[model samples]
Target: MARIMSGVQPTGNLHIGNYLGALVNWVRLQDQYEAYFSIVDLHALTGRPEPAALRHAVREVAIGVLASGVDPERATVFVQSHVPQHTELAWVLTCLTPLGDLNRMTQFKDKSQHQPDNINTGLFTYPVLQTADIVLYRADRVPVGEDQEQHLELARETVRRFNHVYGETFPEPQVVKSSAPRVMGLDGESKMSKSRNNEIGLFETADETMLKLRGAKTDPARLRKTDKGTPEVCNIYSYHGFFTGEVQRAAIATGCRSAQLGCVDCKKLLAQNLEVVKGPIRERAAVLREQPRRLEEILAAGAHRARAEAEKTMVLVRERVGLGAPRS
Candidate 1:
């Protein structure tokens, strides 16, 4: 099986946007690849989360991953910080990465602008670490959203540079984009992000999910039941595309575009359908929460397996780069 790597930040509850966007697709690939799913706690440090919050975030993310059907046995699921090789390799890649290359990363620019008060070296060197995360595992296929395509390109560039100087030790990683919904936020404005405060969490209880969906925006053109609204233009209808079946989606689309359904009626339908999907996830998360030791055991074992593989890779890397064994 081909090796694949992907990471999720342990910042907050991964919302529906995460589910429909990435986790859903990851579940399908678990059996098809030697997958490594990581709770990227180190990556979350750039934003400077509090210690307690960070720890909680890590557990929550792990729970979410397990609940989402990423089998620990099938795919290596561990916290990124557990594998020190990631940071170690990142330093090597950092040296080869040019300032201009990091400067051009659009995500770096966007995130830096958001945190002008605390823009640190970690933020600037973010992509270098990201490059190491993929190449450290020698992953050939990386599942990415449209937003991360640029960074993936940079990782490929770093591989080319390293091969040019140090000889070919790592393969250039490939992008494996998910076919799920592109972007789904709570407020229906921008990407569903915890920082954006515009996300409906995947693990939210049925009541909580419905509450958030209740006041969610709809076609402004839909002021009343009688008025017609275009489902093609409505954000709520877009959501239906994820949870609703093909037959139901076609029906909703036709009804919405024809103004046969009011915005509230449309949203009510979406909320109901969404609950049906999220109900089981919520139940699974509850079960995981009740067993904290289980989550820890999963992580400990995953870290052990990941460390063994990383150590083997680093041995060859040291030899290829003419570095001797560790000093006593």
Candidate 2:
């Protein structure tokens, strides 16, 4: 099977957009690929999270991944910090990467501007570390969103530069995109994000989910109950490409255009449809929460497994770069 690697930052709550866009695809991808899914804690540090929040968020994100059905038996699921080679290799790749290349990255610029008060070196050099994460396992494919296209391309460039300088030790990674991506936030002004207060947590109770949805943005053109909506432009309808079925979506579309349904009524239908998907996930997460040791065991085992392969690659890399034999 072809190896695939991807990661999620343990920054905040997993939302509906995350579920439909990323996590759901991860679940489906495991059956077809040798997957390594990681909680990218080191990557999150550049964002400058509080220590306690980072710890809690990392564990909670891990819990969410397991609850969301990233089976350890199916994929290598671990934290980035567990495997030290990720950093050690990152250092090597950084040496190969050019300053001009890092400066040109758009995400780096955006995130850097957002945190102008504390623009750390880590933030500037993260793309190299990202390359290390993918190339450490020699992953051939990575599932990515539109926002990550440039970063993925940079990772490939880093791999190519290293191969040209020190001989080919890593393969360039490719992207696999999702078609039915969840795009809108609770505010519906931009992508779902914690900073924007536009997300519904994956483990939120049914009532909480409904409450969030009720307050969320929908087509503003249909302010009155009798007004007809264009489901084509509505975020709620956009979500249905994943949450609701073919028939449900068709009905919603028809109802919206024909003025047969109100926004409240449409939201009610989506909330109900959501339960059918999130119900089992919530149950599994609760079970895992009770057995916290299981998460530790899985992570330790993943680190151990990942280390073996990463070490082998490092040995070969060291020899290619004329670092000579391993110390006795």
Q: What lDDT would each prediction earn against the true structure?
A: 0.85, 0.86
Residue 47 lDDT (model 2): 84
Off by over 4 Å in 1: none
Off by over 4 Å in 2: 180-182, 324-328
Top-TM-score structure, candidate number: 1
Worst 10 residues of 2 by lDDT: 178-187
Q: Candidate 1, residues 39-139: lDDT per residue as tens digits?
A: 88999999999999999999988998899888998999989999998998898789889899998888888898889988989998988889888988899
All candidates: CA RMSD (Å): 1.4, 1.6
TM-scores for all candidates: the values are 0.96, 0.96
Error of 1 at 138 (Å): 0.7
Candidate 2: give the clashing pairs.
none
> Highest lDDT: which candidate?
2
